[model samples]
Target: MAQQVRGVIARAKGEPVRIETITVPDPGPGEAVVKVQACGVCHTDLHYREGGINDEFPFLLGHEAAGVVESVGDGVSEVAPGDFVILNWRAVCGQCRACRRGRSQYCFNTHNARQKMTLADGTELAPALGIGAFAEKTLVAAGQCTKVDPAASPAAAGLLGCGVMAGLGAAINTGGVTRGDSVAVIGCGGVGNAAVVGARLAGAAKIIAVDIDDRKLETARGLGATHSVNSRSTDPVEAVRELTGGFGADVVIDAVGRPETYEQAFYARDLAGTVVLVGVPTPEMRLDLPLLDVFGRGGALKSSWYGDCLPARDFPMLIDLYRQGRLDLDAFVTETIALDEVEKAFERMHHGDVLRSVVVF
Candidate 1:
């Protein structure tokens, strides 16, 4: 049966999102309908609203979500009705060349549901990141539903779907942070702080948090940063280097994607060290660098997409880590809000006031 549910939708470009009735079709081939329990208001949602992502208006905003599978379509064996799951935007198609090469993390043919969810006026809503969970219920590819332990709270566990996973994955996967490594993260927002936690989890010996904001640096410290550097008062590169035997950190992650931050990350790592860029940047942004330095600083310069996460593998493990009180995922949830509060959440995000304002359905 076709179902109509209230969802937060961006009706026009640069306009605030409105909660409207959206018609979700029954689960089609390899799709599933999930009853959204909670969804985090991510920067990507705001980016879509501001036309930064594209001209896809009337976008259904909300991707970081957790819920229970309510229905499934043909050939959907990944999950079944009543299964508690975290919704992921990347549902890898195993036949993609990237997946064929055993690097499913870069799966070129990731998928969403084949069906289009539309408004009551019959306008098709392009869901943000292809998994719109701001609604009370949403339709997505069955593979997008990653079943995790039900013991975790929706507000806490749902974060693994986006920012948290991206941060954790940035350090553990992209940075290859090893035991006894010295790690530093610039711009200690949700993603950066998660990297701090991930570095700690990876057995990093010294984790340094760097940010212009004292509050964020303190927050990063709370999340497992062994040291904090206020970049506003001190040169972060010099500070990070001083903290790590004057050789810079082994792994330096830039959670703020601005070119200035990116350059800082480039020079703030030790020789043959890794730099992970987990932040999003605008198209107009550009950076300048010495080609010789790129050759001299001989290590990986990598960008982590969703933390190189395979939701099926990372989400469950992260949830269990949260359950065991190891990951401290709950600390990332600064507030719980309704779907209508998304715009306000953006305001807080812009001000760097809150880590996350999650929407509880």
Candidate 2:
């Protein structure tokens, strides 16, 4: 049976999202229906509303989410009813070449529900990142659900489905910040601060946070930054070098995803050091760096996709850390809002007034 439930959707480009009655169909083969408990208002959701991702209109927003499995379709064994799970956009297909090589994080093929979710008038919705979770209930591929500790707060645990995981993995997995390494994170947004936390967890000797906003810098320091740089007032590359014995940081992460910030990251790392780009950029955005600089750097320049995370391997471990008080997932949540308040939350996010405004069901 199809169930009609309240959901938030961007009916058209540049329009405010509104609560609408959406039809969620029962799970089919290899699919499962999730009873959403919490979903975060991510910048990507805003991007969807603005039609930045693609021409996929009427997007069902919200991807960073946590929920409980309500039902499973035939042949679904990865999750069962009543299982607490975090929804992930990347549901690795084991048969992909990357998965066959044991690097499922780079799996070329991912999974989504076979059936389409639709509006009351029967207009099919394009789900944000293939997981339309900003609803009371959503249907997803069984592999999209990563079971984790049920005791973890749904609001905090849900974040691991996206931004937080991206940041942490940017530092730990992509940049390879190890013990005693000096790391500088350019951009003190949620993802940047998570890089700081990841650096600290990796035992970084000095974690330098660079951002235009003083408030975000302060937040980064509290999270784990050993030093802070106001990039607006100072040359970030020079400041980072001065903070690291004039050799720059061992690793530099660009979380803002702008050409200027990326340039700063390029010049702010030590020669033979790594540079990781985790920020999302627009399609028209381009980078014009000197080819000599790229060759002379003598280290890796990597782009992190979903923090290069393998959900099956990372989510449960991170959730456990969150439960043990090692990881402060709660700090990322600035406030909680109802589903109807999503448009208002977007305004707050645009103005940088909150780190995250999660929708609690």
Assess candidate 2 and give its TM-score to the true structure.
Answer: 0.99
Where in model 2 is the C-alpha error above 4 Å?
Answer: none
Question: Which one is best on lDDT?
Answer: 2
For candidate 2, write residues 1-361 as lDDT tens digits.
Answer: 9999999999888998998999999999999999999999999999999988987889899999999999999999899999999999999999989999999999999989999999999999998999999999999999999999999999999999999999999999999999999999999888899999999999999999999999999999999999999988999999999999999899999999999999999999999999999999899999999999999988989999999999999999999889889999999999999999999999998888888899999
lDDT of 1 by residue, 1-361 (tens): 9999999998788888889999999999899999999999888888899999999788999999999999999999989999999999889999989999999988889999999999999999999899988999999999999999998999988888999999999999889998999999998999999999999999999999999999999899888999999999999999999999999999999999999999999999999999999999999998899999999889989999999998888899888888888889889999999888888899999999999999998
lDDT of each: 0.93, 0.95
- For candidate 2, the per-residue lDDT at 48 reads 93
